[model samples]
Target: MIDEQTRSLLAGIGGFDPTPGALAGVVVVDVTRVVAGPYCAMILADLGATVIKVENPDDPDYTRTFPPLLTGEGSEPLSGFFAQYNRNKLGVTANLRTAEGRELLERLVARTDVLIENFRPGTMERLGVGPDRLREANPRLVYAALSGYGQHGPYRGRPAYDNSAQATGGLWSMNGPAGGPPTRVGTIIGDLAASLYGAIGVLAALRHAERTGEGQLVDISQQDSVVTLTENAVVAYTTEGTVPEPLGNAHPFVRPYELFPCRDGHVFFGGYTDKFWRISCEVFGGEGTADAHADLSDMATRFDPDVYRDRVRPMVEGWFRDRTKAELEALAGDLVPLSAVKDIGEVVDDPQIAARDMIVETEYDGYGALRTFGSPVKLDVTPPRTRGRAPATGAHTAEVLADVLGYSAAEIDAMRQAGAI
Candidate 1:
């Protein structure tokens, strides 16, 4: 348990409000590292779960050394990447190779509502803390495993990273410009999508456990998650016998639904629907242009490849070429869907993002204030939030041992001295 003084200190930090969150009474054992599992656990932590991050004492989570390092005089360098996903969690160390360490993990599982991990399949079984054993110890424990493949697939034993998952999951095949080489996504969507699914599974399992006193494994595969996000590409192939290929900035079936260059920057214009197309004609081309394109107003005609290529595309391109993003937005008003293609800098300072509290600040002791993306899951009464900064390695080992597991100070000291913490 955090002392009052320590709680006060933490509450003083930016984004560390003490309001009780939706998952306030839940405990999560985060036996994860790097992106996928840690991010899933972080989502629970942000919702006010008391998350205990367990790591090996000698060989901690390697992402703790990830880039954008923060260094201060007489202080250890901290990883901004790690901090971005690990905030609002306590830290503990347990080297699962040893009997004492494994026992420590069992104790933690016995007391936790959820235990999440992302090691390659069977790593926990090798460590003697597999889901079967842990769930046997606590029948109501939600065991969530996030991995590149899954726990029981042919590729379960194979090693995979984000790119590997994307490649295998069919995202790479459908992600590049038309007629160009297949390309991996710009971000780690494979891992992130799996994390989201894992979180959803955990919440659902928690609800089941609450009603039935039964817990189950949430097996989330990055490849499977990525496949689900292919946006009808698989169906397009299976039904029509046509392999989906990248269409660059344009929608596969939507004519004139793509990015167009403006006087200042690019803007995405979705004038595919008849209503929006009419609005676009009125705003950009006026009545004369609308009359000229009267036959193209029919959805079937506009969606035809030859019609779009020879007629619709030329006119839409011409309409946007002379206008700025702001002017196009003004013309669009609420009649059409249009948006400027904002870079990261512009997005960071965007008024809509600011108004929605999509950017938030978190303060570290020596690091001052660091801003990161805020939670997209907003709850009215029990809003999810960053409760505090990420903990240093094993920072709360003794506290958690004593407070949650009912361990004495001397026992914790002994475990630390024995290199089992």
Candidate 2:
């Protein structure tokens, strides 16, 4: 564990203090290739759990073909998008279709504490690394699987990605501008949500296994996960027979709760009460306007949004146009519930993000320093660190087998010669 390179990295950062140990002593065998699975593995890796990313030779992270390669060269092999998700771990490739590859995997599993994968339902079972087989190999191994609908459902075997989950999860139904076409969220929300839950399940299962020598299957359904975020939309549908529709930028039940255009960007003013609405009007120059009427039951009462929108829309538009984004934000003195829309650059440079180490640099010679996201989770005792740059495909194959799996140099060369990796 006393790696000179790792120690040097710890020293180069300003607040370097070496830890004699890391959390839980858990090692994750990551068979997750794309977004959700890789993202979950990365979280475990960031939390100081050793994660070994497993990929096949032919389809070694298809994200490498994504635009804006981390190397940023013409037709480079490494994509920035891929690097974004795969950082803080070791990458190894194998031709899993081969018997040698499967044997090698079974051997690796003997020492691995957890296994994570996001394959179509039954893919692992077909490969003989399914939940039952894997548990048979190591009964104490926590196996987490991510799929579209779930391990079993009408849609279990259907193809699914982020958008598919959003549509099926009832999330897309509640998105977009009011009366506009239902829209997908701009972010890969479903994938990220599932990843976060997957990581949580992995650690929880690991804890259980440590306590009782019992490992269980983590069945992650992306569709169900996105619905968790939709909250009352699901409740309203279940309780009131209401199908939630896209309310655009506005909240479904709250009037004047959406963004208004400023001279620069948009300023969002959210006051959930009529008293606050009157106060908002006093500030935004809409005091006695026809649109800014008070229901007395107030803005919080679920009422016809059309009436409120008609009363407040013009006044808000006129006032917002008179001020720049900064001036509008400033007027919310002592916090009048306002925020200006900011782009990614602004988010990256904001003082708060910098203070929290929300960004980290990956060192590569030609790439120099690659700016990527940092861990957001804060631990009081031992916080997460940017361990290292992502490894190239098969770059650590020989090294990992020799060191972690006890393969000889000659054995690795033989595996290489046999096209097993």
> How close to the true structure is residue 70 of candidate 2, measured as C-alpha lDDT?
57
Instruction: Give TM-scores for every candidate, taking all chains together and pairing residue i with residue i.
Output: 0.94, 0.88
User: Which candidate has the top score in TM-score?
Assistant: 1
- For model 2, the superposed segments whose C-alpha errors exceed 4 Å read 1-24, 72-77, 274-282, 285-297, 300-307
Candidate 2 lDDT, 366-407, residue by residue in tens: 666678889888886767756466767876677667666677
lDDT of candidate 1 at residue 128, scale 0 to 100: 90
Can you list the residue pairs that collide in candidate 2? Answer: 70-80, 176-248, 177-248, 178-248, 291-311, 291-312, 292-311
Q: Pick the candidate with the highest lDDT.
A: 1
Candidate 1 — which residues are off by over 4 angstroms? 1-16
lDDT score of model 1?
Answer: 0.85
Least well predicted 10-residue stretch by lDDT in candidate 2: 9-18
| CA lDDT for candidate 2 | 0.76
